[model samples]
Target: MTIRVLIVDDSKTMQAVLRARLSREADIEVVATAGNAAEARQLMRELDPDVVTLDIEMPGMNGLDFLEKIMRLRPTPVIVVSSAAQAGTESAARALALGAVDCYAKADRFGAMGTEDNGKLASLIRQAAQIRFDQRAPSIPKVSVKTQKSIGGDTRLIAIGSSTGGVEALQILLRDFPADCPPTMIVQHINVNFAAAVARRLDSICKAKVLLAEPDMPIRRGQVYFAPGGDRHMMLGGTENWFVKLRQGDLVSGHRPSVDALFRSIAPKIRGHVVGVLMTGMGSDGARGLLEMAQAGATTIAQNEASCTVFGMPRAAIELGAAGVVAPLDRIAEHALSRAA
Candidate 1:
């Protein structure tokens, strides 16, 4: 099937560059282009594209506002394109929180561009086109309070891993957490530019205090730790009273702050004191690590297929017999809280 895409950017050069790069893919077709949000909205209706390549810094109706509108009205997958800089990162991350499906950071103007970068963009667009868009307010099944599982001990820690549709998925899951929830740590595959913004955004909405994890930062209850975006891996470490540590290393599971890295790091120390929750993502990064958690007697919960934006990671864990329980997005928080409490 042809993946029709609409390009929205104020800069004619970038728009042409994006269109040219994307057109190299056999299945992708650039149907239309727009210079701003108003033009983009009109083209979206006229072209009815499968996906959108959005620029965050457009004049008159910025990408973030436009993204929210698209999600509410049309609901197609959107890939945000921004510069590989700190300012660009904040806008892109905000776009994700507002419902963008993916983000791509461009190389600096003088930096040499490569085929691999273009290839990754095409791959993300294709994967997004294949996915069925998951809305925020779907028909929720009636949750039975009696169905809640009782975990035995005081929940010492919680670890979560996600990617792709994670921004919304994590928000949905974390909104249910109590103010005094367990010391939670998360590894969500996001661009380094927007990692801190994402944590701050979540901190504003969530009951728990969410902050980007710093090297040697001690972990404690009621505060949620987030892995920063970059070439470094965020892992759980420290012997007595755990702390988050960042390591510079080769990518694991195709990501620096990989779900696998987080899970593998926490595996040795969990020992029934932690709850591991692997949510919606497009890869098998956290599968093996979740198995380690389960083997270590920690309660492991995988988001069920019915409620997943993409079931790859959760399905991987379930197939590996790593998940102790499978729950929908809505019930995951409840289950995790029950297990932890």
Candidate 2:
């Protein structure tokens, strides 16, 4: 089946460029283009495109506001396409929090354009079209937390991995934890430009300190580390207390920051002291690694289908018999705390 797409950008040049880029794929059809949110709303009603590629800095109604409206009214899968500049980073992050399924950086400005962009764009379109749209619910503002308790001295480590719809899923799961939550490491599949923005956004919503993980950095309690670099897999290293270690390796299961790679490494290193959680995301990047963690006696949990944005990763883990318990996104934090407690 052809994947229908709608391009929503204020710039006529950008719309043309995106159309040209996406046109190369035989399975993709650019059904319509809208210069602003008002036009987008009308086309959305008329064209009924399978997916939408949205730009953040549109005139009049901005992308974030429009996205919020779409999530509330239409509930379609959206891929945020934005500039890599600082302001674009902030807006793109907000769009993701508002319920965009994925995000991509525009390639023309960087002067490193390639077929890879076309391939990725096409893949995103196909993936978005397959997403169960009505399953999406409106995003609620993050709740405020009064105080956070640091993980107890006996708590060893926390590891997580996600892809596809993971950006919003991770935010919701992390928002409820106390500031002193376990020393957590996350491997979220995302483009390089958006990784920092994701970390910053999570830091604002969660009580625990959140920052992009760097090689050789010491892991500290009450801090959460994210793999900022997407081309490498993040692992734990060091003698006294394991810290973040980034390494370039073959793409295992089609992802660089493969959840399996991180979880497999943590299984033997942290062993019984670790808590491993697999949230909503597409594909099976973390299934086998989660199983390895379960074998090593670490507590393993999968987000149940009811709360998952995409049920692929968690379902794969459950099928592999990796998860010790399958709980909804709202209950994951309390469950993790219980294991650590």
Candidate 3:
């Protein structure tokens, strides 16, 4: 099916450029373009496009405000198209929390992104088009610190992998963690520019202290580490004393900081002492590695399809027989904590 899209940007040039770029895709059709929220709102009501590509910066009503209105009122799938500056700001993180499927960072001022970037955007648009907001699970009550079971001494580490809807998923999962949760590491596929902003956002909502992982940083309880998005892959390192190790490498499983790399790195070293979670994402990056982790006797979990924003990664893992437990998004944290306990 052709994916119908609405482009909402203040600049006519950007709208034209996006139109031209997307026109190259055979299965995507730009149904309409809107200069601002007012135009977009009206066009949305009439056209009812399958997806909306939105810009964060707009004149009358900002893209974020408009996005909030859309999600609250209409619930169409939205993807935020942001400049470099906007991508690095908290506004980008807020866009994800507000229900945008993904954030596409513009390459330059004129929106002259390369062919590969355009293809990525096309793929994202296709995924976003498939989203059904009505299928979303109800919010889960967070397990209070006082009620959580004591962390078993045998469970020393927790590692998580996510992409696509991960910014929101991570926030929800981490909110259930106690202040003194186990040593945890996360690899969420994201733009390098938005990594720090996402970390700050997660830090604010979570009870555990979240930090961008650094080379040789020792993993410790009560602290959560995120692989800072860039050229290097974050690995669980050291023989006896586990620490973060960043290694330069080509893209593995179509990602530089690949989830497979992180999961495979820890599988042999930590064995049953670790809990590995593969959450919502678009590809099979973590499937094989998750299988290896399960083979190494680690407790493994995957987010259930019904609750996933995009069920690709977890579906792949489940098919590979890697996930020992497949739980809904809201119950994932509870299962992880229970297995650890």
Candidate 4:
């Protein structure tokens, strides 16, 4: 099926470049091009495109403001396409929080749009087109932290894997965690460039200290270690004295910093002392490893379909008997903590 797309950017040159790139993809068609939020809104009312490519730095109503409006009213799938996203800036992370389905790093104003990323952007467009949005509140209300407490002795570590809709999911999940939560490890599939910004964004919101994992960094209570994106897979090291270890490797289950690698690594060493959570994502990256964790007697949880933006990862785990429990997104934090407690 053809995926109709709307291009919204202040620059005519960027519009042309995006149009040209998308034109090469037979299944993708640029239905409309708008220079600013006003024109974009008008086209949205008329075309109802399957996907939108939005530039954050637009005139008048900014891309973020317009994106919030779209999500609140029409609820359409939107991809933030901007140099701001490419730079792994705070604006890019904010776009995701505001309900953008994905972010595509585009060439800067003075830079040339490279040929290598054409097909990649097309792939993202195809994926975004398949998403269905509902007219609901754009943000999840932060959970009250007063009820939370420190982790139980049985739960030595908390490891989480997510992709696609993970940013928002993690935000909601972590907010409910106590200030002195267990040593938490997270692998959220993302653009390598955007990893730091995402970590920073999460740190600002959560009670626990959220940090990007560094090689050989010791696991500690009250901290959440986020895997660094790129060519290395983040794994657990030192059985009794656990630390984050980044290993250079080819893609495992189609991701470099794979969820499977992280889950599998922790399974044997920690055994029943771990709590594994596989949240909203596309594809089955964490299924097998989650099974391994379950087999090792670790408490394993999967996010249920009702709350997942895309239920692919969790569904795969559920089918494989990997998940010890399947829970809705809202209840996951409480449930996981209960298991740990």
Candidate 5:
């Protein structure tokens, strides 16, 4: 099915560029474009597009305000467009909290690398379009490396990868963790610019300290590190003394700070000392990596579909025979802790 999309941004240039970019897709169609909430509201009613790419810094009613109204009334899948700025970061956070499916970050001047930028934009548009309209917030609801023996003795490291419904899932999973929980790290697919915001948000609610992963940062027990979501992958080193090393380069498993990168990194370094969890997401980014972790003697789990907002990632892992156990979102924490400790 062709995915119909509406573009809502104050800038005509951005609108034109987005239009040209989205036009590159064979399945995504630009149903309409609007400059303000008023126009967008009208177009939304008339066009009934499957998805909407909304700019948070709009003229009249801001994107957050309109997003609230849309969620309450229209309920279309909305991906927010934000600038690569501090304000944009905050706004993107607010947009996500308000139920925006995802966010897109644009450089200050949108045309520095027009063609390349558009290609990225085209990918976002296509992904945004694939989100099913029935997908809703439930309020906190890989690798072919090997098959290892059931080596169990207190999990030393825990790594998780998620997307789509990850923020809420992480919140639910981490809230109950005691201060002495195993050193943990997560790669949640989100806008690169908003990674810090998410870390801060999670820090406020988690019993464990949640901080953004830094280069050469030591992995400490009871503290959770989040992968910075931009151009780098978070890697693990050191067998006895664990540390995080952020590497900037190509996207691994289709993401920087990818779950696969984090998982596979730890596999060879610390056998039987890790537990990997692949949760809700839209693709197969972490499947093979999780397999590597499991085969290296680490316990691995995939969140079950019943509790997942989107079952893509977990499903993929299960399909690849990667997960040692499949569990519901709520039960995952308990299962991990039991296996880890």
Candidate 6:
């Protein structure tokens, strides 16, 4: 099936470059191109493309504002094409939080001529086109009192691993966690800037304090530490009582902040005193680690396929016999809380 794409950029040259790069992929068809948000909206209604390539900087209506509107009105998978500057990173991070599917940094030299390096652009377009879009409307699930509970003495930690659609799924799960929740560590497959933003966003939503994980930091209860992506693996270290380690290591399973790394560490360190949750993501990044946790007698839960944006990670865990339970997204928080209690 052809993946229909709409390109929205202020630069005519960028539009041409993107069109040319994507045209090489037989599965991708550039249905329309818009130079601005207004034109993009009009074309969106007319063309109804499967995906959109959006530029961060634009006149009249910026990409961020347009992204918000698109998510609220007509949800479509959006790949942000941004520069490599600091400002670009910040904007791209915000775009991810606003529900952009993915982001690609344009080549540094491309800024001078307003043209992209076709090679890199084509690679990104291929990846973006393969991403499965979640069209579910945004609505906060009603908070249930039954879903919130205190952690048990045996359940000393909560570890979560996710990728792809994990950003939105994590937001929903974290928002429901209580202030006194167990010490939680998350390994989300995402860009570096977006990882920090995700932690901050979770901090705002959940009562628990959320911060990016640092090397040799003490693991404190009721706090959440997020693993930052950029060629590093978050591990467990320090003394048994206050131990937590975030170390830089080789990429495992093609991911730096791999869920497998985190889960394996927890299995040997925390053992039976942990609760593991695997959420929606595109790949099998967490399956092996989750199995380690399960073998260690830790409680492991996989998000049900019906609620997952992409069932790859969780499905792998289930197939491996690593999951103790497979629950819907809305029920995952409650399940974790219950195990803790």
Write down the TM-score of every candidate.
0.89, 0.93, 0.92, 0.94, 0.84, 0.87
Q: Name the lDDT value of residue 103 in candidate 6.
A: 77
Sliding window of 10 residues with minimal summed lDDT for model 2: 143-152
Q: 156-248 in candidate 1: lDDT tens per residue?
A: 888999987888788777777766778899999887777888898889878779999999999887889999968888888886679998999
Which candidate, 4 or 5, has the higher lDDT? 4
Q: Which window of ten consecutive residues has the lowest lDDT sum in model 4?
A: 133-142
lDDT of 2 by residue, 1-341 (tens): 88889999898877887887897899999999999999999999999889999998888999999999998889888999888777788788788888788887777566554544647777877878878767754344343332134334466788988887778878888877777777899999887888899899989988889988888888887899988855798988875678898999999888887888889888878634778999888888899999998898888999888777788999999999999999777667766766442
TM-score result, candidate 6: 0.87
Q: Locate the minimum summed-lDDT window of 10 residues in model 6.
A: 109-118
Write candidate 4's Cα lDDT for 1-341 as tens digits: 89999999999888888888888888999999999999999998999899999998888999999988987788888889867334546788888877677888886346658545648789888878767655222335557443364346567898999988788788888888777888999999887767888899999888899999999999999999999888999999997899999999999999989999999998889645688999988899999999999898888999988787778899999999999889877777776777532
Candidate 6 CA-lDDT value? 0.80
Q: After aligning candidate 1 to the native by TM-score, how far in Å is the CA of 169 from where it should be?
A: 1.4
TM-score of 4: 0.94
| Tens digit per residue, CA lDDT, model 6, 206-233 | 8889988887778888889999888789
lDDT of each: 0.83, 0.83, 0.86, 0.85, 0.79, 0.80
Which has the greatest lDDT?
A: 3
Give candidate 6 misplaced runs (Cα > 4 Å).
20-26, 88-90, 107-139
> Over 4 Å off in model 2, which ranges?
112-118, 136-153
- The whole-model C-alpha lDDT of candidate 3 against the native structure comes to 0.86
Q: Residue 102 lDDT in model 5?
A: 80
True-structure RMSD, every candidate: 3.3, 2.5, 2.4, 2.3, 5.7, 2.9
> With candidate 4 superimposed using the best TM-score fit, by how many Å does residue 327's alpha carbon deviate from the native?
1.1
